[model samples]
Target chain A: MELDLSVEIAGLKLKNPVMNASGTYDPLRYESLVDPNLLGAVVLKSLTLNPREGNPPPRIVEVACGIVNSIGIQNEGVEEFIKVKVPLLRKFKEATFIASVAGLTPNEFAEVVEALEGVDIFKAYEINTSCPNLEKGGVNCALDERCIQQVTKAVRGKTNKPVIVKLAPDVTDIVAIAKVAVDAGADALTIANTYRALVVDLKSRKPILHNVTGGLSGPAIKPITLRLVYEVVKALDVPVIASGGITSANDALEYLLVGAKAVQIGTMNFVRHDIMIKIIEGIKKFMVDEGIKDIKEFIGTLRT
Target chain B: MKLVECSVTHNLRVRPEYHILGLECGELGSIEPGQFITVSVDSVEMVLRRPFSIYRVFENRGVIEIFFKVVGKGTKALSELKEGMAVSVLGPLGKGFPLYEGVTAVLLSRGVGLASLALLGDKLKGLKSRVVTIASFKGRDADLASDNEYVKSFSDEVIVLYDEDRSSDVENVRYLLNKVKPDVVYTCGSKRLVRLLKELPYEAYVAWEERMGCAVGACRSCAVRTVAGYKLTCYDGPVFNVRDLIL
Candidate 1:
């Protein structure tokens, strides 16, 4: 018998436990690679109030194990995304649309949420606290509880839609900052954004990335993301969306077993575009083989 | 997007010291100028595909020709390619340069930066552009790997410039600008020549080269900072208006 794949998080039931991560697979560009209709949901790149061209070149620096990127949230802003990207993305087959957003100020965050209102394609918002909080000392908003509460409250006040706070992994106590967001009325949380890192060229005697710093992702960060997911699950009663270094079906399964209601695929999709579909199908097969009828049955149920 | 193999029948060097490695891929079968191919050069050292512009494609003895220079790690790896060893390739990407259909007096290159104009010379010849192919040398004994035979085959009018030292390149550049006085100027690899031509009163397109991280416009690595904005050299152009770029 086929297994029931629906999994609920933040009052919405995902058709499956997997969603393409923000900033990884863009449906507008790779439409030919996959049937967007097959995806559970597609989280878009981080949007801001103003369009950003992103960082200068030498943006990518290859490391020993993986890669680092200083893309600086290059996006077409919320206005263009609604005008151009939404109508195209709405064509996806039963896929929920999650808008990932970044802003320098709390007001900036609210402005985009308010702008996106009435767009049926937008189901929820992921407040990217990982973005360099320009108002602060270039320290990410996720690093400070006060910044988290301010941005969360501003966004929550504007729209009744569920908000998922995407926290940066560069913080000292992520749980405290998460609790601050939860207290300020965020519906759920996505544990960990890309970790801050760097690489250098031996010949040039200079940093590899032009920006000198970038976010590191891939197989190297899986354990850290998983640990964060476990801690967030233990701390908060609300749902947790786990992301970072999820490259396989088992990786998704592990996130679910640890406590993530949904898993977002990031850099792995660039290397293998079909990894999302493979993971989704694999989850169903595991459920069938285990005689499990639904995805919730596996959430946080690690065999002791 | 046909992928064909080209063998290195001959590797010659010309004045201004540029490596002209020729591959007998096949009868490029109606190849145009400005088109490029992604060539794979693999070993224990590096593992990635390097894209090279089809410098010159010719049909002789039923074999196609693809030419390139030793510019980067990929090119270095390609240069080390044995005369008989086969290399994998993906080809003829993007639109090629427009061969002037009318009798247009285009300023041909006369220095080391002449690679950009090499293919254009052949294309212009086909369309029969006044074909003023002017080439020059850096200095005496500066003939990198001067092969007299290969030089005679390409140029319609080769202008050899003799400079004493470092400053002669600038004076030679001014002389060519005045002598050619052509309607349009096209350049390939030299930033110095492109910058020089930018001041001249002529429509020019400087062929740009940047390290392409992902060629399919995904990474946006090979972007040239133009006056308008950052345009992808791979997608938007491997060519741009001389005035549009900062050089």
Candidate 2:
């Protein structure tokens, strides 16, 4: 029997539910390595209103089953992104592009969306309020109910396109934040970004990252993020996009079964460039073997 | 560029900590000097693939060599592998040293920094350019200089400096810079060395080493702050002109 991998989130049709996590996978860098068309979408690295230089050296370090990074949202400004990067991305006509925006204020968030409104290439806007590495407008905004509502409402007013609010996992009550985000007009939710973390160098007796702290991602955080997804999906009405330490199709399946409409591959893109292709194949194989006709049948099917 | 499954033909421990890993990759494509490969460690415990500079490439023999120090678990696991074992490698990554033809070139490196420049000296020599290679090491590990014969195979002259020898210090680098007055300078080493080279007026390119999440540009983890802005060492460079870089 033929299996269907197609999914729709906030009206955007995805070939499958596998997409690259924002800032983890750059389609431009891996154009030669893997076909972008194989996955559902490609999320560009987070862009801010102005060009950012990012943090200094020692930006990442590997732990037991994951990695921590203090990249600090390094990117060319939104104007350059619209003028230069968008045209380059247009060549990948078969792949869906999701523009991830990071801002220091509500006005800045709306400004980025307004600039991207004319670019037909971007199918969705992922407001990255949950990034823990930035000095300003990162997880701090995601922590406050007022900030979440303000950013969501501001971006909602600017673009008719789908707005997906990416939340951080460090909060005391994720459901409270999700309620405010949905109420403020978030079309969908990227259920949790990297967890805030620190790693001390045993030899130096100092922090490993130049920024001293960064966000953690990889298989180590999967169980924690999976539990968050399960909790948020059950409490919220909108579709949830799960991201954190997803390396394989089995990882994606766990999120799907727990109610994630899509799964974003992070940290693992560093392990292997062809991971997305392997994941897509694995998902298809799982579906066929299980006698499933539609992938939607598996969404939120976890039994208590 | 491509992920190829290579078999380890040789893994020789030249020094107590350093090993030269040779992989037999079939029809290995064009790999320029200063380019590197990210080797996937066999252990599930080490999640990140270790990046190593191309020490040597025997294109005709379908073999490539990497020089690495077993500083951590990833390289330690890599050193444990025997011959005929399959290893996944992604290469020839990052922007390599630019080809300087018909010009006098001076190469300066320290410790394992030589691993990145070993093939570069060969490439410069092939271009018929006058090449002078200077390597610096700690006092006791001066024996490492003699172990890498390839360093001398291609350079017109090779100088080894020891930290214990006061005469052959940073001041000597300045003396050599003035003495050579070469058209181009290529360097790879500690940040301290790079900072010293940054003050020089020559056209210099330095291969930077950073803790990388993705050896590709995606994660932006290997970022180096430059006058222009931040650039990924994994993407914009493992090599960059000294003028553009802040330090």
Candidate 3:
């Protein structure tokens, strides 16, 4: 029996449901280690209007089953991405390229999309409204329903390309926020970015990261994000892209069963560069064992 | 850089807190002087791989040496390994120090920062360049140079400094710098020492340290603030020119 791993999110067609979360996987860095073409899509690091220097040292720390990071979306900005990164990414023809954009204001978000208007390499745009590590404009936008709608609408007006609004898990009612994004014309929803967290060094009696606070990712956040994904997907009409603590095919399958159209791998990429291959193979093997011919049969098939 | 499982030849505790691990890895092709390896400890509790500088590489013998302090859970777990144990290693990763043959060089290493530059001293010696090493430790008990004979053979002169005697330490380093007036200087230490070394007149290269993820630069967790922009310590460098870095 042949298993179909293909998934269609928004308008772009993905070979599988597995993709990378922004800022976690750099294709340029891992291109030689793992074939980017093997993954369903590659989400580039979040970019701003201008190049950012990011936060100071001690940017990451490992806790029990998770890692806290305050990288602050350090990127070469949008213009540099178009000139340098886009050309490099264009070589990977098999993978759908989703450019992740971050901005301080709605107008800035539109400007970034305007700059990327006719570039054929990019299949869609991931408007990052929920990065907890940034000093401003990231988590703020996702928390307020008005700001989420404003950014989504602004980016939607700029490009005909599908827009996926990434939401923060820090909100009180993530379902309400998801509805706002869908109403504002978001083609899809990336349910839950890292949760805001802080780790204190016992000996030093101070924070581990220089920035004092960061976003937590990995197995620790999986259950929390899983619940959020289930709630948001149930409440909204737009496709939901689950991204939090997805390390294995079983983890990805859980999200798919709970109504996620696709899943993004983040922290686990650090454990092994070739992890995606293992996940893809695992997913195929699982479908065969379960006698499932198509992935959609299991997607959103969780028993209530 | 490729991932390979190497057998541990020796795991010696040179000091009470520090251990020097020796692995028999065959032909780890072309590891630069300042490059590092990320070591995986096969324990469920330890999820992140620990990054260690290549303290020494005996090419002919196919042995790679790493010096580490049992500071936390990861390193403490690594310290328990015995001979013949297979340890997963991802290596020759990150940018290394640039070697300029026939030029005078000063190597300043503080505490465990010595692990990064110990091999560079040997490389400079091979280049027929004048090399002076300043090894500083928190106290006499913390010094591991006595156990490792490689440090003595690598540099022309090795000066030991103690933090307990701090009043004359900076002056002594300055005195040596004035005497050598080398063409270039390289340092690896705490932020204070790096900041102090930055004030020196000559061109200097500093090996930076940070809490890293995906020591291969895939994860943007190990970023160093530079004058130009944020540079990945794992990719752009663990070794960066002092002038380019803001701190």
Best by TM-score: 2
Task: Tell me which residue pairs clash in candidate 2.
Answer: A218-A245
lDDT for each candidate structure: 0.71, 0.86, 0.85
- TM-score each candidate: 0.74, 0.95, 0.93
Over 4 Å off in model 2, which ranges? A131-139, B140-142
For model 3, residues A1-304, the per-residue Cα lDDT tens digits are: 8779999997789999998888878877886677889889989888888887678878998888878898877778899888987887877878788988888787788898888887888889999985332435354677888888888999999988899999999889989888999999999999879898999978899998988998899888899999999998787778999999887889999999999999998888887667777788999999999998999888999999
Which candidate number would show the highest DockQ if scored against the true structure? 2
- Sort every candidate by TM-score, greatest first: 2, 3, 1
Across residues B172-225, which tens digit of lDDT does each residue of candidate 2 receive?
888887798888888887766777777877888899888877787788888887
Runs in model 1 lying further than 4 Å from the true structure: A1-6, A90-95, A202-204, A272-301, B1-174, B177-190, B207-223
Per-prediction tally of clashes? 7, 1, 0
Contacts from the true interface found in each model, as a fraction, amount to 0.05, 0.86, 0.64
- Order of the predicted models by lDDT, top scorer first: 2, 3, 1
Pick by TM-score: 1 or 2, better one: 2
Candidate 3 i-RMS (Å)? Answer: 1.7
What TM-score should be assigned to candidate 1? 0.74
Estimate, for each residue in A1-304, the C-alpha lDDT of model 2 and write its tens digit: 8789999999999999999899878888888787887789998888888988788878898989888888777888899988888888888889999999888787888898888899998999999985432435354787888888988999999988999999988899999999899999999999889898999988899999988988888889999999999899888789999998787889999999999999998888889888988899999999999989999999999999
